[model samples]
Every structure is written in structure tokens, then in C-alpha cells.
Target: MNAETASPILAPPLITFDRVSRHFGGAQGVTALDDVSLSIRRGEMVAIVGASGSGKSTLMNILGCLDRPSGGRLLIDGQDVSALDTDALAALRNRRFGFVFQRYNLLHGLSAAENVEMPAIYAGRPAEERRRAAHRLLGRLGLQDRAGHRPSELSGGQQQRVSIARALVNDADIILADEPTGALDEAAGAEVLALLDALHAEGRTIIIVTHDPTVAAHAGRRIRIRDGRVVADEGDDRRGSPATAEAAPCRPGRSGPVRLLGDVASAGRMAFRSLAINPLRTLLTLLGVVIGVASVIAMLAIGDGGREATLRRIAEMGTNLITVRAGAPGIRSLADLTSLTIGDIEALSEIRGLAAISPERNLRTTLRVGNRDYTTMAQGVWPDLLVARSRQLAAGSFFTRDDIRSYAAVMVLGQSVADILFPGQDPIGRQVLAGRVPFEVIGVLAPRGVSGGGTDQDDVVLIPLSSGFMRLLGRSHVSSVTLKVADAGDMERVADEIDRILFDRHHIRNYQIRSSTAAQIIMSDSQRSFALLLGAVAAISLVVGGIGVMNIMLVGVTERTREIGIRMATGARRRDVLIQFNVEAIAVCGLGGVIGVGLGLGSAVWLRRLGFDVLITPMPAVMAFSCAFLTGLVFGWLPARKAAGMDPVRALAAG
Candidate 1:
């Protein structure tokens, strides 16, 4: 009797159930609650007691907005909740009722303080404000020193205290506790019941659902439910006057840009906390993204470096130089081989854009000096040959125009030929035999590396065109006419002019025209194709990494089903849960991307040290990072949606 029976209930019922019914497995399946009708007044301490499978828990769940009835209307403060959406239900739960579970349902990863601050977080309270409130709640609950400890570090009673603190974080008026002291010892249970008494003294409605008769005895009003029906109502009529509950209205969080940013920040923090729980699993998930991004950046760098090397080689051959070879377009018959003559070179020289022109006759022969013999290519040209081919003299001067006019037996030896024939001695003024013809070496050409065809370019000798034609070949026609255009932009025009002049002179098309400009174009196309091929290969790895992310997130959703239920129970909306999981996935990929970029640049430098050309640029790193982020966003969606779409009651019931 005492103080419990003395306190009168003043209410136009705060919660009402007008014949609510809940069923599982369709209408003919398990009937958890059937035609349940009840009304609880404001500031009343009511205990709903029943045995197992008696629908007491179902009634409590419906009262707390954690589950919806299949039939009939449930009202809160005279407002029907049957028409409310999931978000509206969640807001009502967060602002009106505070739940304390039998098992204490505290997230094992979060500290006590963090667990207490959860409701305030969903309430959209600022960080500083939530922190202070959480600490104050923990101190009042006698767990201030254990605020930083995780659930596993706390005893069962301490954890329950922390759960109570979390329930009261948002200052909810109606405390719906399901078996609050069922998992506690006798002393702890007494302490909890005393706390409930204190809350009831402050004019808050308290509803307890339990199977223990001793626990039900603490409430002023006892309602017994058997087989989903209220069998007996024992205790005095506490409803004295028809007075409405005047609890403070709850704010539905915030809105606009500021709220969105806060939600994002909170999601990020939660993501980190959850990921940190299993460090090895998080690391394994990150591995795939890291490898994919690193491979992309490194492959692109190598491709770009190779292209640069190729283009430089083409430039070395000369971009503006054109070659007019004496042959038909495809077939080079004996008659077509003699189509280019000295007249063609002279006519091409008269073209407006011609910088220098040289007529060349080539023959592969053995050059011998003092019994030392070497097989090499011998080319006959004028003094302008050096300028046309961009050749430089290493020691001596090139053959003069007088040597061409006089048909002098003088030649310039390429660096490779000079090294083989002259050995350690100077080649200038030395006599060398080319196909039994003695020739004086006037100069030695500087070294030119291997050509694109993988053959040495410095293994040749140059002689006067007149000497090669009259003394060696005994012919007037030259092997080829080489021209150096004044400007690269004028190459096409000058080639056309040369074609016209040559057609007028020979009266037939018997020569093939080629240019280094065409070679440059071919090289460019080849480089692009090679780069794309490399990129495509690397992109496959990125796809694999994305799949890995999807698989991990799916497994994560399954493993954290209970956590999701806990969040939902605390008033988190579906979108909030979605954003939380999505932010976790993105954070994983972003961290991996940063590490991958560093690894890729380091790998590029390592390749360079190993004598492999690698061009490292910022664009590839940025692109790889962006791709990683996109991979996370694309792959994380399905799992986040799955988590968000879960039924909170089923999720909470999941093991």
C-alpha cells in the first residue's frame, strides 16, 4: 500500500490501444497479439505481467512503436499512429518513449559515454551539448568513471545502468522497460526498481513488462495478460481526474545544410568506430583497392614514358625531312630503281621551302684499312648531305661540293665504321678501301644510337655522289633524293611541288615519297593504342576490387544486423542508417586510395632506378583516387539499402 498506492494517476490516457492485433506468417499463422485493448494514464506505474508466449512483450513492442499491428488502431496522446510512416514512427519513439531492454542491448564497440549519447545524436543535438548531457547522465547513474569503458569491460549491472542512462539521454517522459531487472542479481534489481520509483515520483509514466511476479509487485497497478488477452486488472483505480499529460514536445532533429553536414560528420565517426572493431577484416578489404589504384597509376606512367622515348627518337630522325626514293609505289623493278637522278635533286632544291637537298646512292660493301675489314653501308652524297640528315662531324669536316664536282675519291666514315677500321687512330687523312676503291677519310660522323628497327645507325660511310655514280656504279641515276624543308608546316606543299617538278622531268610516276612527319603520326597512334591497352588491363583490377568491396559490405550488413536494430530502436531513420554504412565504405576506399597513390609513386621511382622509363604525373594519381571513391559508392549501395530496409523488430530478435 504505502506511497505507490497513494499516488493518483491524472490523465486523459497518454497511450491507448483500440483492439490492436498483430500476426505473423499471414492471417492464419502465429497470433502474437489478438484484439488487445488497453489504456494507461499519465504518471501511472503500470506492470504488465505474463508467462512466456503470453503476448506481453508484443504489447510492449507495439506501445514503444517498435512494431505495428496488422489490424486495429494504436493511438499516442489521442493521435492515431496507424497512418504514420517509418520516419514519423521513429521520431515518435525518439521523443516520447525511452526503452530499457532485458539484455541491455548496448553496442559492444562503443564506450559507455558514446552509448549514452546515441539518442541525442539522433535528436540532432550539437556535439558539445550531447557530450555534456551524456557525461551528466553517466555521473548521475554512478558510472562516471566507467564512461570510457566498452560494454564488455563492464559488469552486467553496470551495463544495465549505462543502458538506463542512454534511455534517458533525450529526456523521454514515458519509460517502457521490458524485463529491465530480469538479467540482474537481487541487489541490482532492487536498485533499478528504486530508480524507477524515483522517476515515477517526478511525474513520468512508467510501464514495465515482465514474467516475474516479484517485479510486478513493485508497480501500483498490475495488468495480467494471458494468451494475448487481458485476463485480470488488479489494483486501485488510479485515474482520479481527467487531466492531460504535459510532457515537453520533442524536436524532430534539425534540417537544411547545417543538419546535413552534422549528419555526415556523425556518420563518419560511427563508421570509423565500427570499422575499428575488427582491424584485420578492414585491412583485408582495403588491400584490393590499394592494389587496383597502384597498378593503374604505375601502368599509365610506364606507358607515357615509353611514348615520350618513341617521340624523341622520331624527332631525332627529323620531323620536317622528306625522302624521295627511286621506286614505284609498291614494286621496285630494275627500271623503276633508276628513276631518281641528279636532275630530280636539282629541281627539288629550287622548291621554295627547301632548306637543303642531297642526292644519295647507297651500296652495302666491305671497307678495309690495313687488313682490318668491316662490312658496312656506303652512301654517296654532296656536302649538303650533313645538313639534310642533321649529321654532325666528330673530328674532321665533311666532303666539299668541289669533291662532288671533281669526283674525288674521298669519304666520311660513320662512328661505328671508324671505330672498327681505324681502331684507336684518327680516321681523317687515312685511306680506306670500299669495294676495292681506295678513298681518303675527310671526317668521322658522331655516334647515333640504334634505330627503331633495332639496327645500329652509325655503321656507314659517306662518299661524293659524283664519285659513287661515275667511279663505282657508272650510272647517272641516284638511289634517293633527300630534302630538308625550311619549315615543318610547309612539308606537304614542298612535297607536292617536288612531285610536280619530278613528273614534268621524268613524265611518269616512278618514285615513292616518304616523310618523317608520317612516321611521327604512326608513332603517335601506336603510343595511344599502347596506353589504352595498359589502362584497360589495369581497369580490370579496379573492377575486381569493387566486387571485393561489395562482398565485404554485404557480409558486414549481415554481421551487424543487431546493431542496425539497436540504431533503429534509438530513432535513426532509414536514410540515416544508409548514410552510416555508405560513409563507412567510402572511408575504407578513400584511405586505401591515399595509401595506393603513395605506393604507386614509390613504385614508379623504383622502376626508374631499375633503368625503366616511367613518367610520374599528378593526373594519374588524382584519377586513380577518384576511381577508387566511385568504386566504393557504386559497390556500397546495395548493402546499405539492405541494412536500411530491415524490419526493426525482426532485426532485434535476430541472434
Candidate 2:
């Protein structure tokens, strides 16, 4: 070599190993490097050669900062690296050393250009800058045309070229090659060695670890390791080992807000790319979250719809109304059915704040018009039934109070009864026999639909109380009394006054009074509880989906072990790996959440079309989506932690 070439080789040592020993398992376990001491100067090409299990690869790993020494100090650029943390070592590898692996170690899902940009991403380079740099490096390596191709699409030689471009992307000063030509054919291997030679020619330190003598012959110096120790050192007798210098201070690079945002963007892109590779698996993973969110949304909407419909129906039944029934806690006798009388109705009329009052005398009786006879409920009520129960007339007029006083047999038919008894015809002025007692239909009540208790409120016949009692089966007692309050605020006080009057008359609490407002509150509370219960059950499904996410992520981490090692070797910190894996999980769930919301809305619409009450609100959709996101976060933790805590050397050794 010329004097100018020899001068750079004789400078201060760039890497020094002082009694370094690396033991796997424990101190008594297998030792990969035993009390080894060596030094390499700047701008030199060195080769470490050994057979299988001879510790050459271990030595290369320790030298490249991918693995740590167990018992001794390693110094780079005259500074001891033994005390440095993992992130500090990562920064050291990023700023100073680049690695080229035998199998190329190119991420399968990333494009050639994207693979080459990996190191610069960890270095926090701008996206456009990294793209330009990656393209430049690929072009220099003669693979620029294949920049958009994935690793699987490239030949072995082209992939190796991409790997070399990746190594050089960070502008590192030292190149560490471990069996770089092992997987390539002879011609491809020669081309790769030639690339290494060209790199060495540019004043960069190069270290090659291989078992092949032909590959080691390209280096100027050769060192042979065997049985965890250096057995031979040849071809560099002129250069002497340099002393270790003082340990220098190092601070790992801290990512700023912009850099963090950039990292998130990069992670998001990578997550989508990874998911795109195996679409079936991604879809399967998303199925659980989608179903869970859809169930939650649909169920809550159904509950809300049912509640609103019921409340509306109750409001339609007069919210300021009260009904008094003639049954108490212990009154099960037949005479209890006859306990309420017209005198009680007259006594209740004496109370103030009463808007309207009606006495009901109901009996299960058969009505016959011509040869057609239908068994139905016969209700004997006063004139105030229309006002008290909020009933409206569809045709004709209601029975007058004089009709009740004179024992005139006139009756009003409910809508359903009118339809059944007098089909498609006006029942006004028509005579219907109530058990041989003829009665004229004076009016037909409008449809009231089904009550909350599942009873048809319009399936009844109304007659004058006095006529029904005196002329129809001689019944003198009333079944129930319906009362409408003038003011809703006076409902409780009015109920109390009625109770006192009934108690003074009957001398017992034999009557039960129910107010519409109280019923509304009770029904609302029950509905709310029902809705909450449905949500809780649906939330269980979401949790189960989250568990599915956790399981799939664990498998994904296993499958991407080597990729994790590659990123770490290229300067990615543990937090970066964690963020990458975690974001991938969240992306899966987020997409599922969107699809699930659409599905839920469609389901609700279908249910509504099928005659079910379904109410859809934005808040439920938002809540369901938010729950899906949180599920991903909670369940992704374990897999992300497992990936971040991986040992890079072991991970790289993984298939």
C-alpha cells in the first residue's frame, strides 16, 4: 500500500474490545466470546472467519452493537459503550454502523424504495428527503428501476442490492456484513463482494464475518475465532493495537413533536401495507369487532325506539289521568268484585280538582246482531268516560246523562267491536242485543291501538251505567272508576282525597288508585334499566373481540420477529416498535368500527321495515366506535410489549 493509504489505517483505533466475553443463559452456560481483546483502526477492511458454532457471528454482533458483552468493555471511536442503554446503542448503530445480512433482511411487504428508507425513518429524516435519498442509493446500486417492486418480486441479487442500498441510506461510517453472500449464487456473490470492495475504497471501515475462505480472501486482514476465543490473527502484523481512551458522553436523539407526528404517519402507512398483504387474515381479525359494534348500536337503538313508542302511547292515554280499581292486597273474594258501588262514584265526585269522572261496570257478555253473535267485554260507563279516558267519537254522538237516568238502553261501540259487529257499515241507530236486552248504537269510539300491557283498548262496548245495572243482568256494583285531574301537579293530592273518601265509606283500603304520571316514571326507569342491560351484554361481545385482537397480534408479532430485529438494527427504539404494532391493531379495529356502524344502521332500517320500532342516534354510533378503539388499545398492549422486549440478535436469527 502507498504511504497516503497506510496513514489513515494507522490512525487511532475506531473499535476496541477489552477482555470481552458473551455468555448465553448464565455464567456456567455456553460462552460465545471468552476474554477477547482486539482493535480495528479507521479505513481498514477486516474479516472474521470460523466454522459453524465457532463464535465468529457472535463477535460480529457484539462489534455492531446488536448484542452486548457479558464481562468486558467495548469502545467505539475511543469511547467505552459498556454503560450505554439500549436506545443509546441504537443511536450509535444508526449514526455509525450499517449491516448487510445474508438473506437480505428486506421487509417483504415494503417496496424496495421503502425498504431502503427504513434507517432514515428512524433517524427522523423528512419523508421527501428520505425518498430522494433512497432513490439515489438504489440508482447508485443499479436497482433504481425496481424501486417500487417488493422483495418477493425481485431476484436474489436485486434484493441484495436493495439491502446494500438500505445499509448506505443512513450514511453510516462502518459496514458490518454477516454471511452477506451465503444465500446468493456465485455470480451474485461476486457482485456483492465487489460492492463491498467499492464501499471499502471510499474510506469506510468494513468487517465481514463468514465461513468461506474465498469470501474472506477479499479482505486485507483475517482473524479466525474458535471455541469462544480468537485462535489466529494474520495479514496485519504492521498495525499495533491501540489503548482504550476515556469514555465519552452520549445522548440518544429525542423525537420532537414534528418527528413524533412523522413517526405516526409512517407507522400508519406501514400498518395498512402489512394488512394489505394478507387480506383474508385481516378481514377475519376485523369480524369480531365489527359484529360487536353492530350489536351494541342496534340493540340500544331498539331499546330507545321501544321506550319512545311506549311513552308516546302513555301520553296519548292522558298523562294527567288516574284510575281507581276495586281490589286491594287481601281482597280475593267474589264479593270484592262487587265492592265498588255508584255511591262511591257520587262520593268521589264531591272531591275538588276533578276534571272528569266516570264509573265503570264491566262484564264479559255476548252481543248478538241478527244471526251473528260475538262474545265481548261490555263496559257500563257514565257520560264522563269520553273526557276521563280521552276517548274520541268517530261517528254519531255519545249517550246523554238523561239516557242513564231514564234506563234507556243505548250503547257506544269501540272501533274494533264496531268493525266486528257491523262490518263495513255504519252502526249508528242499529239495534244490538246485549243478552236479549236490545240497545241502539249511538256512537263508535276511535281506535286507541294496543296498550302497554298488550291489551287491545278499543275491543270493548260502552253503555249507560244505570241502564246496564237495572236492565242487563241486574248488576248494581261498579268494577273501576276513571278520573281525569284538572292539573297534573294536583294528581297526588287528588288521589289522596279520593282514597280518604273511599276509606270513610268502605272502612278499608279496598281500592287501588294508579296515576299516569307515576306509571310513566316507573315505565321509563324500567326501560332505562333494560337499555343499560342490553348495552352491557353487547359490551361483553366487544371485550371478546378485543381478546381476539390480542390473540392475533401475538401471532403477528411472532411472524414479524425478524422484521422487528431489522428495524432495531437500523436504529429503531423499543418505543418505535411498540407504536408500530399498537397502531396496526388500532387500525384494524378502527376500520372495523366504521363498517360495523354502517351495518348497524342498515340492520335498524331493515328492522323498521319489518314493523319493529327502531330509533338510531348518532351518540350510540359514536359510543360504539369509541369502545372499539379503546378495545384495540387495551388488548394490543401485551403483544406490543412482547415485540418491544425482543432480543434483536435472537430475533434476527428467527426465520
Candidate 1 residue spans exceeding 4 A from truth: 1-9, 236-244, 249-254, 329-337, 352-356, 364-375, 382-447, 461-476, 484-496, 515-519
Best by TM-score: 1
lDDT of all predictions: 0.86, 0.86
Residue pairs with clashing backbones, model 2: none
Question: Could you tell me the lDDT of residue 486 within candidate 2?
Answer: 93
lDDT of 2: 0.86
For model 2, the stretches where C-alpha displacement exceeds 4 angstroms are: 1-9, 236-254, 306-321, 327-343, 346-356, 363-378, 382-412, 421-444, 451-454, 463-477, 484-493, 506-530
Residue pairs of candidate 1 with colliding backbone atoms: none
lDDT of 2 at 31: 91
Cα error of candidate 2 at position 443, Å = 5.6
Best prediction by lDDT: 2
- Mark the 10 consecutive residues where model 1 has the least summed lDDT: 236-245
